[model samples]
Target: MFTFFIALVCIVFFFLFMIGLFLTIKSAFKFFVTKSVTKKQLLSSVIGTFLFLLIFGVTAVPTFGNSSDNTKKVSKKSDGYDFKSIKLGMTQKEVSDKLGKPSSQNDRAITYGNNTLYFADGKLTGGSPKFIQQQVNQKNSNDKQKKADDSNSEKSAAQYFGSKSTQKLADQASYVPRTQISNGNMMYSETISNVKMYRIDDYQTGVTTVYKADESKDDGLGAILYQGKTVTQEKPKTTIVY
Candidate 1:
């Protein structure tokens, strides 16, 4: 809304500036031809033109600043992720070292939300099969299936995001941050090591989204970390008077 207001103001100022310029030019032409133009008319035209131009230039600053800011945001978000970097044979310690502690852990598996890593002899085995397979299945499916699969991958990969450690990870990676609203939900997003991440609030089931930056353009979702119930509100009930 603020952006829209600034744009509207810019348009108004630009229109005024153009009109003032035209009038000033016409006054100059008339003065050159008639050689009897009043000083008041010439001075008023010049002043009006200069004033409108100044106002337009001032209004334009925020417009250009916003464009530059949006460009920077896009550039920051365009970064790529390589979740495949977390290999099958990586040690349990190595996985923990890379992604931080799991939300829940046991002898055979360590979990991040619904995504889990299985281990044999303290070495990493597997996690996020849907996400891993997305690249392999990219060409064999239709757009609808691809989108469905991507949504699933998002849920699976989301296990790694929206945690306390994720904030640390973003800081370590020097990722840029931004806040925006989508579908009436307020979201906070950041570019992390290998994914684009989002945290959103106010829904029946809050879901954090972790996108493989190169392929997924969908903004990340959810308010809470994966593996936990997010904020929810029950519908207000109405009772009939007895």
Candidate 2:
């Protein structure tokens, strides 16, 4: 509303400036031609014309200055990636042409910051570390808390691996139960694997159901239901001194 007011005032000033300039030119011409116009009257017309132009120019500067800033903000917003341009079966060169260079790359995949694009037989297959691809197209702040929940889920999900005492520690860290496997059996994600697997534990049965990360869903890390997998907390193998 305030911007509109400034713009309107600038237009009014410009209109007045044009009218004053026309009147001043007419008075000057009459003064020189007929010699009947008073010098004081002509001088006053010139002064009024100068004031109008000066005021209009000053007001016009800030109006355009504000518009320039708005244009920059729009430019910044449009600068983000058009991920839809990336299609499956695109060659590595084609992907690079659209998205520029990757942050890191190897034989199978190229990474853009956190998001990785996977390839097979020198053509695009899909992306890796699934969380990043899910986050790529989201422009709002609504999912921020859910992301924090996922990280916490990963950290404490491993806590469900061991004895009852360990499960107590996992329970204390706050897990958002994503799915119900059965009555009294629930699925929660413990992102204990670097390869992204799901570990589901039953609170009452003390039985944990593990699922491999589903490649298809945005919430691929949670509640996809694979059974009979052993839950072992990740630890380094001990080296024996020879």
Candidate 3:
């Protein structure tokens, strides 16, 4: 809206400026071509042209500043479009009451801009896949670091046993691998290192662990991390009141 207002102001100023400029040019031409023109008339035309330019500059610069301020205000509040009143386990009708109808929706979820809210059992179960992705990456990094530390410890033990701590184990394999799954609530995830990571919506609960898939399994050493998000809701209620 501020943009539109600024544009309108510019348009009005543009037309006014053009008219003033044209009149000034005509008066200037008359002053130069017609010897009868008075010195006062010529000075007045010059002053009028200067005033028009001044007005345009004054109006335009402030609109730009105001437009910038409006942009800041909008960015700060855009999240309020759908976050403040929404909660986990609200029915779709309740969600609509709070956030209005989603821009698009399907049986399981709805989308607003880049955000997506998923549901299971007919209630707003969860959203924020991005947060889940962050956890997956963090868990894998920790897992890989653990594998390195373990490798170093083994080398130190070998050196103590009078064996040369030569290099990485022959079984050292790919980078840490991970996977993920989410529903209305927290997710169920499995990282290649054999650690599970997930978070609740409010982020009030957190657990930390390092997984070693290679060490935990029959494999010798190394980590592979694959990732995914799963949507699950328990006893999903499908009906919506109103």
Candidate 4:
């Protein structure tokens, strides 16, 4: 509606400018031919031309400026995710109500807790085959990470003499388990391993281990790191323990 109003205003101003310019030129030509150029006629012509140009400038400037603003608004709307109302743990229905249906759904899951929802345009679309595939992928990735940690723990334990020391070593070498959360536009990974990682493909920022569960205290190893490199690394390796 606002757009239509602005466009209508512009069209009206454009026609008015054309008419004013035409009259101004006609008056000037008449005065030149008759050799009776009156001050009043010249003033009227100048005023008409100035008014037309002024109106044209006014209409044109806002049109260009408002177009940029409208572009931003439309872009946000088309992205299928509203940043304002989104929150973690929102169900597919809730997200749909806020963002409407997704443009496309692929094999992706935006997982939180036991409830896994389909991911499309950074938001949860619904539960379907694509969602299931994403769940399987996540489970597979988690399983692989668990196995890796176990292997590393076992290796660390073998290097330790006593069983108590082995257990401690195993715990120390384990990577922090993370749960994925998103603003529908950005993904964040939270873990009790004293590290909070945020990832959007190659762009990542987070902190390193700072707390130990057994001691229930900070380990002073807490360090923040920003990954400026792209995350286009090779596909993750997986091993099935069974």
lDDT of 1 by residue, 47-103 (tens): 767866787677676778799788888755542233555666677777777667777
Tell me, what's the RMSD of every candidate? 29.7, 19.4, 21.7, 21.1
**Ranking according to lDDT, highest score first:** 2, 1, 3, 4
lDDT of 3 by residue, 58-87 (tens): 877788879979888886565446365666
Q: Is candidate 3 or candidate 4 better by lDDT?
A: 3
Off by over 4 Å in 3: 1-15, 23-38, 73-82, 112-115, 121-242
lDDT of each: 0.61, 0.64, 0.55, 0.50
lDDT of 2 by residue, 125-240 (tens): 66754433554435224467677776667545443442223344345447533456657555554445453555556666666655557768775654433444333344447999
The digit string of per-residue lDDT tens for model 4 on 1-242 reads: 99999899878888888877886887788788997868877887887788778876787788887998989997655443433464444565666576566554334654333334555655444443344455557767898999799655533432221112222333543442333335322222323233233322212332112211223335222222332333223444698898
User: Which of 1 and 2 is ahead in lDDT?
Assistant: 2
Error of 4 at 54 (Å): 2.7
What ranges in model 4 sit over 4 Å off?
A: 1-12, 27-37, 83-98, 102-151, 161-242
- Quote the lDDT for 20 in model 2: 72
Each model's backbone clash number:
3, 1, 20, 1
* CA lDDT, candidate 3, residue 22: 73
By TM-score, the better pick of 2 and 3 is 3
